[model samples]
Target: MEASENWLVESLRLYQDFHAFDLSGATRVLEWIGDKGVFVAGYESLKKNEILHLILPLRLSVKENQGLIPDRDFKVCHGGFSDKPVFDLKHVPETRLLVTSGLPCCSLKVWQITEDSDVIKAVSTLAVPEEGNLWPRLAVFSSMAPGVLHGARLSTLRITDLESQKTAYTSGIGDSEVLSSLQVLGTDTFAFCCTSGRLGLVDIRQKWTPSENISPSPGSGGGRWCADIRNGGQGLGPSIASFCSNGQLCLLDPRDLCHPVSSVQCPVSMPSPDPELLRVTWAPVLDNCLAISGFDGTVQVYDVTCWSGVGSQVEPLFTHRGHIFLDANELDTTPLVTTHIWHPCKPRTLLSAANDASLHVWDWVDLHASS
Candidate 1:
């Protein structure tokens, strides 16, 4: 592995209050435990027969930058044979953590975190019988019922009752295409992006089923390799933000799925630009703002509030290249930033992990800050 430049590290010390940690593994899912200063992440362990999760937190230091300390470690298994990275985790409101993973040996596990300490107690566990083998590509908790977990199980959407171990409902997410990402819109509604270049809105209430799905903008050449999907937060109600496979960021209003509010050419990752390497997420504290990663070993934050419908390129408000340092030639070496997320309670604070097993918890000090 290559090292960052001394000059760049020196510059990062100027206004970047950041800390890095070695997770010893790579994870696809990262979720904050509500407003707490802690978060949970999980990934497959090739050496072990199962997956391991870490409840890690950043320790605020007065004398130095914050550092991530491992709080707890837990294991969830019977999913070692999954073909794709299907391990996903989400925090439910009732002190419960919902998790799903597995293919040939499918299983779902729920754990309860006590209010006293980080000790996670196993509340429930269920194994999806081999007869149905409904592998989950994406999973999220149902806002209406804490016991229900909804997942995009390949060809169909499965809303399973974790308490009773029964399939509550099933519907088509897309004609069997892989689901890239899923975001909960409301109690019984969700927005998702499929590998087939389709962004869809599905609601369980009102017996909702759409006859058609929406495609990307016309200028996108009719092919969308959607990498990620997220709901626009704060004041943008019913607003959806999706990073297309074509490297174009799209603003969408779920009320009219067929038409996009705007489409702009977002920056592509350096060295290699692939949809699978890129991810998008909106901030809980900022409006018309979102973060994009897997772009040349850095996370770029942009404010779309100023996006003009002319299809022009929008510049990022902040460019975070802390993951990789420029060589003497000033080019990035480790160019893939695996995943990034915004702090639920802290404004402008970001947590990101890279392919090199480096986890970062950093806050950019805006000289001219905004609310």
Candidate 2:
């Protein structure tokens, strides 16, 4: 029995070493694109090396970084019932589903995926009134807090209860413009960013009017347009930050609930006069850095400090070529990068997807350590 136990321990050690070697030896790229935009959510299962990606194909395939996901080979939803998948969710490991916003008529669609058949099972179909176009954003806050998902349009931001499968709350937001980004900041509070350079705070628990019209700087030509609010590493108040249209990164202090506490301008020179930073994501483990993808086909890493102060001390740390284009006018040249995402688990790894149909991954190197 002693000898058998010893052999088992040695075999497990050998297996660990083999897995590590295999993970570092080669690189694999997973691509998913269809008529809908590519929006990906990841799940970590109990099985070792099990990677599952819920890919929503927008106009282009949105590919996720492999480093962020553990298991490599997974499912790719092609069709079945729904024409376009607009929303997807992967909050837990065991049970995962994809939700889509119905086209034309305006409805909510859900799907349960099975590996054995490689077919997406239509779970539930919910409906919404045809008010405007649906822009869906789903977020899982706390394990026990239930789930709150939202979608945007030109006129309003609608919230849906995932557990109840009903519209719990709706905010009549956005003047004549469209909302670009929405984020959950607190237990029931969500921050909505618009294309016309405005930020609104909605407390779903309250029926009163929400707080809106938050501009980062006076006469700064409104915010860059589309903005995403991210919690600083601390996961506390004043942790909120935004990436603007003008390539500026600013911090939003929900504690004050009035104005931004600090802001940081990007160091990279704009490729053109009308430059839009497509996506800004926080580095998972690196607290002092933020990753940005812009319209110039460049992925940049910035050193950030005092995220909620007058302005974050921003410094260009690294830059890599990206694949996306900012707009149609710059198509003759390299298109500007439109989206960037950091690996949820890997601190130094990033993925940038652009209109160029080219997805690139960046691995940040420690300059001092290498030297």
Which candidate achieves the best lDDT against the true structure?
Answer: 1
For residues 176-216, write the lDDT of model 2, one tens digit per residue: 55555666666677777665567677777877366765444
Q: Which clashing pairs does model 1 show? A: 225-245
**TM values, all candidates:** 0.76, 0.64
Tens digits of lDDT, candidate 1, 1-371:
33455646665643455666665455655666554434434454443322333433434323344454553222221122223343465666564554545443355666565555545555665555342433455456554555444444345556676667677656743455556666666666666676555777666664546422545456666444443334432234436676665567777665665666777887665323545556778787776678887555788888888775747888788877766753222334563577788877677778887766567677786654643
Which 10 consecutive positions of candidate 2 have the poorest summed lDDT? 18-27
Question: Distance (Å) between predicted and true CA of 300, model 2?
Answer: 1.3
Score each candidate by Cα lDDT. Answer: 0.58, 0.50
- C-alpha RMSD in Å of predicted model 2 compared with the true structure: 12.5
Range of the 10 consecutive residues with the lowest summed lDDT in candidate 1: 72-81
